[model samples]
Target chain A: MDSLDIVFTGFLISALRSATPLLLTLLGECLGQRTGVINLGAEGQMLVGAMAGYGATAAFGNPWVGLLAGAGAGVALSAVHALLVVGAQANQFASGLAVWMLGFGLSAYFGAALVGQQVTAFDSIDVGAAAQWPVIGSVIAGMTPTVLLALLLVPVIGLWFYRTRTGLRWRAVGESPAAARAAGVSPATVQIQAVLVGGLLSGLGGAALSVDYTRTWAEGMSAGRGLVAVGLVIVARWNPWWTLPAALLFGGAEALSLRLQTADTPISAQLLHILPYLVSLVVLTLTCLRRSDSGTPAGLKAVMDR
Target chain B: MRDLMLSGPGRVVGTTLAVLMLTGAFFLAIGRDPVELMGLIVRSAAGDGYAITESLVRATPILLCALATALPARLGLITVGAEGQLYFGALLGTGFVLANLGATSAAPYMAMIVVAMLAGAAWALLPAVLRSHLGVNETISTLLVNYVAALLVTWVVYGPWKSAANLGWPATADFPEAFKPSTFFDSRVHSGLWIAIGLAVLLHWTFVRTRWGLTLDVLRSNPRAGIAAGLNWRRNVLLTMALGGMLAGLAGILETASIQGRLQANLSAGAGLSGFLVAWLARNHCLRIIPMSLLVGALLASGDGLQMFANVPSSIALVVQGLLFVAVLLVGGYANRLQVRRG
Candidate 1:
């Protein structure tokens, strides 16, 4: 490949890699929002998950085991959120913020040993000479398992939210829990299930960062991707299908900023680092301002109204 | 069943005790001596004048930040962007002083403080504008602005504002001696503490006395009725958020003017989050913010000592705060239900 082509291809691959965590997080957040339980603790969930994954991997020398442990850690934190918001009917934002702080503290406290230590991260898939084929090859060749899984989820979640009977009930719960209850579908169960699964996905996203992408643990490593996924959920208009493109857009922003650093842009490096967040703000603003198809979910409206 | 407990204060005390016991249990769970560290935590925060001074220095900004948070919350808004506002405040303060390097006087310092507050307010108002006009979620947008604020600080200090004396370090030039706030009691205690106290008292007064304050109270208790009564909510949202942002910015300016005396990478250092916690724990009441700020400040200061006393990460405090916040919310739920039942 020519040097320019090589750069573009490399950028595309890295962008996908960067977007992997966000994809997982965005989907998880969308599920929770769909259930009418807004989770702002994704950052904490990811942080703890990253630590659990890294620590487990280091202790057991098995990345899969570590990943499961990470997801378990996420479920654990999200359970606290469910107990508070669902069981106690506490303020959602405050509870979520508490979860975030707990995750921050838990990770920093527990992951102190894992800092500066490297885990056996995911290696790229070997497709041999088939990967050498031009444009499509760059996308397929040497991609990690997480990236492939995230790609699969785009279709799977879309199907799960659209094709399944359970998915319709999930939408019913999000739109109007009282109505869902009247229809004999338990809103509480749907909400609890959605938040739990969403937390697991968020935890997996954290593992993606530490074990699959960065191959190392750092305190606060989620770096607000959890929050970014939240904004993406709004931009996606609470649809699971929309998460795919929105996450990739954020991922593209991430890749462009990284490329900008090495490409000799006149903008200060610090300014460039903020590019993804700025993009999130712009996209969020535009999405909110645009008068669109369906109104916000009934459950969300009820909570926001209060 | 026969005896009823008094309400809010009783719950507060009970929650405090519960948190302490829970924290002690946590220390035990972690296989550390709870008593040793618990004693050390109190001692490190206030056993001596030096520790007290350091904590007061820390509490000054937190008090201001709590006011910043509490104000917006009173008007039914969640403004957690104090971290961003503080940075912008500090950045403007430093920039203003840098721009007038040749002229050194307290007059310029006053102007710089005013600009710092304004910058903080403007940064805060940016989010409010979206929330009020477009119905945007302030929680997430204000948070996004924090990263932007942090980056802007880095960009300024390392790029345009880099000083000759920095010696390859990423720092803005030192402020002129003229602008530095005077120290109190001939120690590290600065006059900024008084400014923080002054603002806290001023806010408490405004919440009780002013028409705007009365409007905020009405808005808080019954936003629908207030709106039904033809109160202008959009302007009020803007005012509360801007004022809150200004307080947070003033906190930043005080830190810049007193502590750091120049801009650096570690501008915020968890003050914004701590401020939010303070405001929450204080129930967003103006009168409660002062004591809550001191308590949270000491809690944070003690966290710093956790590493020294036990080889444990100081972040144990964050976990504790998390636990405490969850408990408070759960406890508050009962109070809300009680109020509704009485009504």
Candidate 2:
């Protein structure tokens, strides 16, 4: 293959891989925020999940077990968050920050031992008919199976969240606990479930980073992807479906930056490295400017302010 | 104050026990002895005067940052960019010295320190301005801006301020010896310790005695009530945030001048965000900050020892912190609900 082809293929694959971690995280965060709780601990949770998943996969030699362990870790942490913010009425911000600190420290401490370790990852399932097409073939050539699963999961969640009976109840609880409680819905249970599912998704997202992206465990590997995911969730305005494009945009910026660094261009490598963060800031600021009430989950503005 | 201390003793013991139990369980599951780890941590952190002094040195910037975070947190502002603010302070402070000092001199060093403080404060002003005016949430904005500041600092260091002689690292020339903080008792601890302690007391006085402080307390309790009571809520929030930023900026200055002595990429010892944690654990009480800072410092010191004694990976500290934070949040949530029920 020519250098151009290699660069293009590398960028495409990196973009897909980078976006997976953020995409999974944002989707989870979307659910958590939709239930009127901001899980700022997404960063911490993702880190812990990454470590847990990596450790489990390495120990058990089963990627699925590792994936489950990661999700379990995420859920466990989310349960703590749920107990604090929903059950005990702790300041969600403070609780979330605490989670971040704890997760960061723990991940770093445990990850040091797991560094230089490798895990077997799932193989990609390429669609042959799709591959026959020109532009579309390029997109799906090395697409991780989990990415497709995530895509399918989004519409299902979107339908479940907005169109189903339980979905309406969850939305109602998130919109106003008082109203929901009066209507015989238990906001606590709804929030607990939302948090649990969010944690599981976040764990899966973290696992994807190890299993699909790097295919190895590294200390502080989550970096700021968890935070970026949280930002994406905000940009998407708690909409599950929007997380895909939002994550892809941010992920593309990241991939482009990496490509620039490798191309040995005259541009400052540091500038390119920070490009995605700059994009996140710009996209976030612009999204904030839209003044669309439709994006915000009903009960979230008050919860966020508090 | 005495009543609160006495009343909270049981809760403190209970919380400590809970932490111990959880940590012990984790250790057992990992086939490590918790008691042995605890002993190793204690020995590394406080077994000798030198170790204790090092602990204090590490705690200095954190204490200052905690104070910075505490001020605005009282008014319900979350500043996660203390890390970034510190970097900006260090960069600007370094720039000030580079600009003013023709030679390595004490006067120039002092000026640079002052400049760093101001720069950090200025960096913080952007987030506060957006939050106060544009109604942007300070938490996410500050968090995002931290990455920006980190990048900006890296840019200046690697681009214009690159040390021509050094290879494979992004760092500026070391600060002149004269700019370094004076050591305490022939120990690694520096004058920054005094600065941190003094700020803690100063904040305590302000929170307790000053009308502005009382107004802030009121604002934190209920913003609408403060507005109804004719308190200038926006102005208070802005000023407090600015002050918080300035304090954080001061931490950045100290790190550059005294400890790292250069515009090191990620220059802070994670003191910026850790300070936020310290401040929160103190329940925004300035008086309690001193001990809280020390506790976190000790934990950090112990984490550093993991590599030496147990041959354990230092990442264990991060895990402990993650566990502690989640546990604390869970505990705090229950505590808050209990408080509500009592009320």
Candidate 3:
């Protein structure tokens, strides 16, 4: 391949890899918001997941176990959120922030020991026949289990949201808890379940970051990607399928930033680093302007309306 | 016991005790003597003059940031944009200092502070406008803007404003001595502490003893009636957000001028978020925020001492801080339930 082709392929591959964590997080936030629970603590959940995943991988010598641990850690954090926001009727935003701080602190504390330790991260799977295909071959060949799983989940979740009875119940609860309760649908149970599942997915995203993407542990390694995912959910207009492109857009910006950093260019790397967040803000504003509160969950409206 | 626990003072004591117990349990789980660590933390945070000064220094930004959060919160707005405002403030203040590098007078210092506050207010107004005009969620918009603001600072420090004297270090030129905020008692604790405390007092008085306080309550509790009463909702939102942003921006600039001596990346050290927590802990009470900010500041300041004296990571401060918030929530929620039951 030519140098230009090589750079282009590298960018594409990195973008896909970067999108994995964001897509997982976006999907999870979408689930939670759809249940009328807006979690501002995804960052915290992701951090704990990243730490737990790395720690478990180091201890068990298995990345899969690490991923599970990450998910568990996320679920544990989200449980606190659910208990406070749902059970105690606490402010969702406050509870979420507390969760984020907890996750951040807990991860930094626990992951301190695991730092500088090496783990055998998840290896990309071989696509035997697909490896020979042109253009898409290289990208397809670089797919890890987590990446494929995340991509597959987009469609699966989309289907579940549109087709399933449970999904319908969740949408109903999100729209109006009182109405749902009158319909004999327990909004509390569904909302709690949605929160836990959201945590699980967020944790999985963090795990993917540590085990599959970076293949290493670092303090606050998830950075603001969890927060970025929160914004992307709005960009996606709370739709499961839309998260795919939304996540990819962010991931592409991230990949392009990294690429530009290495290239001979006058544009500052720090300026490029601002691309993902700035783009998200602009897109989110535009989306909200075009369709004001059209797709917002009614239950969430009550919380934010204040 | 139940009645006492449901009371205001009882809830405060209960939450404090709960947080302490949880922290002890955490230390025990890590195979350390909780008592010794706890004692050490207290001493390190406020044992002596130096420690007290350090705690105060840390508290300054947090106090300002809390005021920032609390201001908008009065109007029932949950804004987590203090961090961004702080950065934007420091960026603008630093930009002013950098531009007037040849000005050998104290006049630029005042101008720099104003510029920074305006910059912060400007940054915060974006979300407020978006929320009021486009019906977007202020919380999410503010949160997103924060990252952008931080990156903006990073871009400047690493690019346009990078000091030639620093030799590749990603920081702007250090402030001239005239630009430095006056410190107290030959320590790092600057005049910013007094400014923060004064602002808190002023705000508390305004919130409790003024017509504006009643205005905010009416707007928050009954927006339709408030609108009918000739109160402008959008204008109030904009004013509160801007004022809050100004406080956070002041924090950013002061920290930059006093502690950092130059604008650099990660300057606020999570002061904005810490302030938000303190505000919540104080239940958005301006006066209450003072003591809460000090408490949190002491806890954070002790982290370094813990890392030094014990083999514990400094992040334990964060863990403890988080636990404190959760404990407060649990206690506060329980109290609310009890009040409801009584009613």
Candidate 4:
């Protein structure tokens, strides 16, 4: 293969790798929105989760244990979010912002020791001899376990939203809580569950970064991926099914930018680095142009109103 | 009916105790001495004139940044983008000073401040426009613009504006001492603290005593009624956000001129978030912002002192702030619930 082909192959692999965490976060936020609460705490949750996953993996010698620990940490943090947002009906934005700081502080304080520690990243799922298949194998190549799980969730969540009774209740609660309450479904309970689950997946997203992707702990290893994932969820139109492609688009943009950075180019490095965020803004602007909100949860929209 | 509720001081004390206890538990879990940490926080924050002065320096920017959100907050727009606004302000302020490097001090100083405020306000208005006109969420728009501002700063420092003398660190050339803000007695704490104080007082009066302020409160709580009553909701949105951004701009100028002395990475250093937290803790009462900013500033100083003295992660302070914020909200919520029950 020529250099171009080599670069193309590398881009595809990197894009898939980058997409894992974003996909997890987008799905998490989607669930939270569907339950009438939009948790802006994903950024902080991801940070604490990253540290928890990395620290646990280092101590326990099991990546799965680390992943679970990360999810548990996220859930614990989100419990605070649930109380402030759902129970008290505090300003969701302020409450979420506070939680974000809390989680970040927790990570920095707890993971001060974990910084720079490395762990063996979880290996991709093993395929039989068919891995030797030329073109197809390259496309379906090595991916962490979390990536596989995220892909599986696409179908599972889509089915759950459409087919299950619980899913219908979630939509109802999200659309009109008073109506759902009249039907004997507690919107509060559904919101709490969804927020916790959102935290759980966000934690997994953090794990996908520290345990399976970066394989090393750092102060802010999750960076702004958590926040970006939340925005992409908007572009995804609050559909869990759409999050997969939206996340891939982000990850792909990220991968392409990194590749461009290494090439001999005239663009400033900072300008190129900003390409991903600019893409998010431009895409979001375009989405808004098409529709104020493609399909917002009315329950979630009500919380935003003054 | 009003007297049936918990008094304001009672709620404050209750929230304070809860936060302290929760933070103590966290410190203990992390293998630190909670008692020592508590004492250390107080000592480092206000144990001496030097420390008190440092806290004031930090509070200057914190107060200004808080206004960036609190002003818009009264209008019921979530403009947490103050952090980015600060950067835009600093970037412009830095550019102004550098471009007019040879001009006599008076006009340049005035120019830099004005330019910084305008730049910050302009950055803030981006999200307001997006939100009011397009129905996009201002929170997300403001949030994303923040990253864009940071990136612009980074590009400038590393590219066209790099200081050749800084030994490869990505920073702009230092400002001449004449360009720096005038300082008060015995310390680095500059005149910016007065601006913070003066602005706080003015904003409080505007929000509480003026018709415009009442209309803004009305606009926030009931937009339809405000619009129906001939209050300009859209204009209110722009004005409040612009005022907020202008305050945050002053913070950026103070940061670049008084503290950093040159543009560099980490200039804002979470000032925007800290400001937002201070605003929330103050409950958006403009007059209360001063004390809240001071409290947070002291905590920041104490955190740094803890890092130096006990080898503790400074972020422990953030954990405390977060606890305090949540605890305060919870107490307020509980008090509201109690009143509802009684009714």
Candidate 5:
């Protein structure tokens, strides 16, 4: 292959790698929002997951166990959110912020000792004969189990949301709790379940960051990806299928930024680093303007209306 | 029984006790003596004149940021963008100082502050306009812009504005001695404290005594009636958001000029988030924010002392702060539920 072809292939693989965590997080948040619960604490959930996942891997020497620990950490944090928003009827936004702060502090406290420590991390799978075939082969070889799982879950969730009774009930709760309750579908139970699933996916995303993507732990390492996932959900218009393209857009920006730092370029690296966040902001604003609440869950509209 | 528990004093005492117990439990979990550490925290935060001043120094930015959050919240807007506004403000203020590097006049210093405030207001206006004109959620928009603003600051400090004298440190040149804000009582506490306190009083009066206060109330409680009463919701939202942004901007500049002596990355140090928590704890009451900020500021200030004396990571303070927020939320939520049941 030519130099240009090699560079393009490298960029595609890196984009997919970077996009995996965000894809996991967006899918989780998308599920929760579908149940009429807007979780603003995904960032916090991701942080705790990252820290706990890293710590667990270092302790147990197993990446799968680390992933489970991360998911459990996320569920533990979201339980607080569920208590506040569903159980006590506290403001969802405020509760989520509090949860974020809790996660930030707790992770920093517990993970302080684990900083700079190394553990065995997930490796990209070698896809045998397909690994030698052109661009697609290179991409397939780059896919770790977590990455492939994240990709697979996209269609699985999409089908579940549109092609099942449980999916209809979830959507019903998101649209109108009162109506759902009248139909004998408990909005509270559905919301709690959706939030837990959101937490689980977000935790898995965080674990992916520590155990799969970076393979090292740092304070606030999730950066704004969890929050970015929140914006991607809106940009995807809450559709399970559109999340793939939405995450790739952000991931591609991140990959390009990293690539630009090594290449001869006039643009400052810091400026390039701003690309993903700036793109998310612009895309979110444009989406909000164009759609003007066309596909928003009515229950969410009730929360954000004023 | 419900009335007593929901009463003002009852709520205060309950929250305090709950926070203390949770903090104590956390210390125990970490294998530390809860009682000794709690006492140490309070003493270190405000035991002596020096400790009090240090806390006030920490409280200055938090007070300003709290007011920033409170102002927008009065009009029913939730903005987590004060951190961004603060950074943008510091960036512009530093730009002014960098441009007029040789000048030693008080006029330039004042002008720098104004420029910073304007920059913060401009940063805030983007989300305000989106929320008002397009019905975008202010919380998410503000949160997104925050990342952009912080990156903008990072870009400048590491690139165009980097200080060569610092020998690779990603910070701007130190403010000229003439540019530094005057300190108080041989402490880091500066005139910003007075400004924040004065602004709190002014805001409290405005909310209680002025026509604008009632207008915000009408708008918040009933937008249709407010519109019928000729109060412009869009204009009011823009005004509140801009004003809040200006205060947060002032905080950024004051912290840069008075505390750090230079513009650097991560300069706000979570002051914006802490401020938001304080404002929420105070329930967005302008006057109540004063004490709440000082209290939270004291808690944060003790982190250093905790590290030195107890050999614990200073981040334990953050854990305590988070516990305090959860404690308040639980108590407040329970009280509200009781009140609703009683009615």
Candidate 6:
């Protein structure tokens, strides 16, 4: 392959890897918002999960256990968020900010102890062998199993959300709590479940980043992926179906940038590094400007004001 | 109805107890004694004149950032991008100081600070313009700008602005001691402290006793009410955000000139977030910001001390701060529930 081809191919492969974390977090935030809670602590939860995942993987010598531990940490952190926002009924923004602070601090503290240690990364599942065709095989060659799992989850979750009795209650609770209450559904219970599920997914996202992608944990490794996920939730209009493609688009931008940097492109590499965020910003602005067609949950903060 | 609420002493006791109990729980979890941690925190904060001075030095930028958000917050506005404004201020301030290297100390340094404030105010104008014109959400715009500012600062440090004198990484040259604020007493505490305090008092006086303050207070609680009272919401929003941006911008300038003396890739070190925390904890009350700023400063100062004495990572303090913040919000929320029930 020519240099440009090789670089483009690499970018495509890596974008899948990069998109995993974003996808996980965005999916999680989607659930949280669907139930009328804006859990801004996704960043903090991811950070904590990253640290826990790294720590557990390091101690147990198994990536699976680490992933579980990471998800547990995410859930614990999210529980704090759920308690404060759902149970205590705090301002969503205020509670979310506080959770972010706690997560950033705790991760750094725990990270101090685990700094410089290396853990085994998860092995990628080969889908190339199953593809039975060259072009498709090449495209799916190094894609992690987590990406496939997360992608599959979108449709299943979407179907479950719209078709199931519980799903109807979830929507009702988010749309109008008074109506939900009158309909004999408890908003608090529904919100708590959404938060718990969201936290689990967020934790899984952090775990994927630490174990499957980065292969090593360091302070602030999640960077602003959690926030990016929040932005994606806005752009996707809290639709799980849209998040998958949005994640791919964002991941693709990041991958493209890294590719350009590696290829010695004349463009300033710094500009490339910012491409994903810029794209998201533009996408968000345009999305906000356009007419809304996808049904946004009534309880979700993004649409509640409108 | 108001009389039944906590009295002044009761509120102080409540806030203190809330802070302490939460801090204690965190320390206890980490296998450290809360009393010892608290003592170490207090002593390290005031263990020596030098330590106390350092705390004040650290606090200079924090106080500024707190006021930045609090100013808008008092008017029921969320200036979530104070961090970005701070960067705009610091970047301009440093650029001005470096560009005017030949000028004598008196005019150039002061001029740089003034320009820094203007740059910050100008940076804030983008969000204000968007909000007033297109009806954009200030929170998201401000946040997006923060990312842009961070990237902009990164560009400056890493690109053409990279110090030609050094080759390995991006960093600006150190400011001359004459241009920089002087350390007060063998610590890095500098004139930024006085500047921050002076600004705080100025803001307090402006918001509490002045006509503008009354107008802002009215606008903050009820924008519709302010409009009904014949206050121009747009002008007041612009002015309040300007003041808020200026404070944060001053923080960035002070941080560069006094603390770091040179701009690095990540000069903020989460001061912007800390400022948000301080503003929230104070509930946007200008006068209350002083003690909260000091308290946060002391905790931050002692984070280093904890690392030094107990071999504990300073980030542990962050966990404590997070716990306190979450707890405080929960309490506030609980209070809201009580009010709802009573009503």
- What is the TM-score of chain A, computed separately for every candidate? 0.95, 0.92, 0.95, 0.94, 0.96, 0.92
Question: Chain A in model 3: its TM-score?
Answer: 0.95
TM-score versus the correct structure, for each prediction: 0.96, 0.92, 0.96, 0.95, 0.97, 0.94
Model 2 chain A lowest lDDT segment of ten: A131-140
**Model 6, span A116-144: residue lDDT tens:** 88897667676645645544455566677
TM-score of chain A of 2: 0.92
The DockQ-based CAPRI class assigned to model 1 is: medium
List candidate 5 segments past 4 Å from native: A1-5, A132-134
B1-343 per-residue lDDT for model 4 (tens digits):
3453377777777778878888889878877789988999898889899889988888888989998889988988877888889999999999998887776658788889999999999988888887877767888778788888988898899998899999999999998777788888869899999988999999999999999999999998889998999999888878888878888887987899888899887688788988998888887898889999999988887888878887878887878877877887777777777777777
- Encode model 2's per-residue lDDT on A242-292: one tens digit a residue: 888899888899889888788888887777877777788778777776766
Could you give candidate 6's per-residue lDDT for residues B35-105 as a string of tens digits?
Answer: 98788877777798777877776677778888888887777776677888998898888888778767765
Question: For model 5, how does the per-residue alpha-carbon lDDT over B216-265 read when each residue is reduced to its tens digit?
Answer: 98898898999997889999889999999999999999999999999999
True-vs-predicted CA distance for residue B322, candidate 4, Å: 1.3
Worst 10-residue lDDT window for candidate 1 chain A reads A289-298
Decide which is better by DockQ, 1 or 6: 1
Q: What DockQ do you compute for every candidate structure?
A: 0.72, 0.60, 0.74, 0.65, 0.71, 0.58
Q: Per-residue lDDT of B1-343 in model 3, one digit per residue for the tens? A: 8889887799889998989898899889989899998998999899999889999999999999999999999999999999999999999999898888788777888999999999999999999999988878888889888989999999999889999999899999998888899988799999999999999999999999999899998998898999999999999999999999999999999999889999999998889999999999998999999999999999999999889888789999999999888788877877777788888
Best by TM-score: 5
* Local lDDT at B49 for model 5: 90
Which model is ahead, 2 or 3, in terms of DockQ?
3
Clashes (N, CA, C under 3 Å) per candidate? 0, 11, 0, 0, 0, 2
Measured with C-alpha atoms, the lDDT of residue A134 in candidate 3 is: 77
Lowest-sum lDDT 10-residue window in model 4 chain A = A135-144
Ten contiguous residues minimizing lDDT sum, candidate 1 chain B: B1-10
Q: For candidate 3, give the lDDT of residue B125.
A: 97
lDDT accuracy of residue A196 in candidate 2: 85
Candidate 5 clash figure, as a count: 0
Q: Give the runs in model 6 whose Cα sits over 4 Å from its true position.
A: A1-9, A291-294, A301-306, B1-8, B164-169, B228-230
Model 3 interface CAPRI class: medium
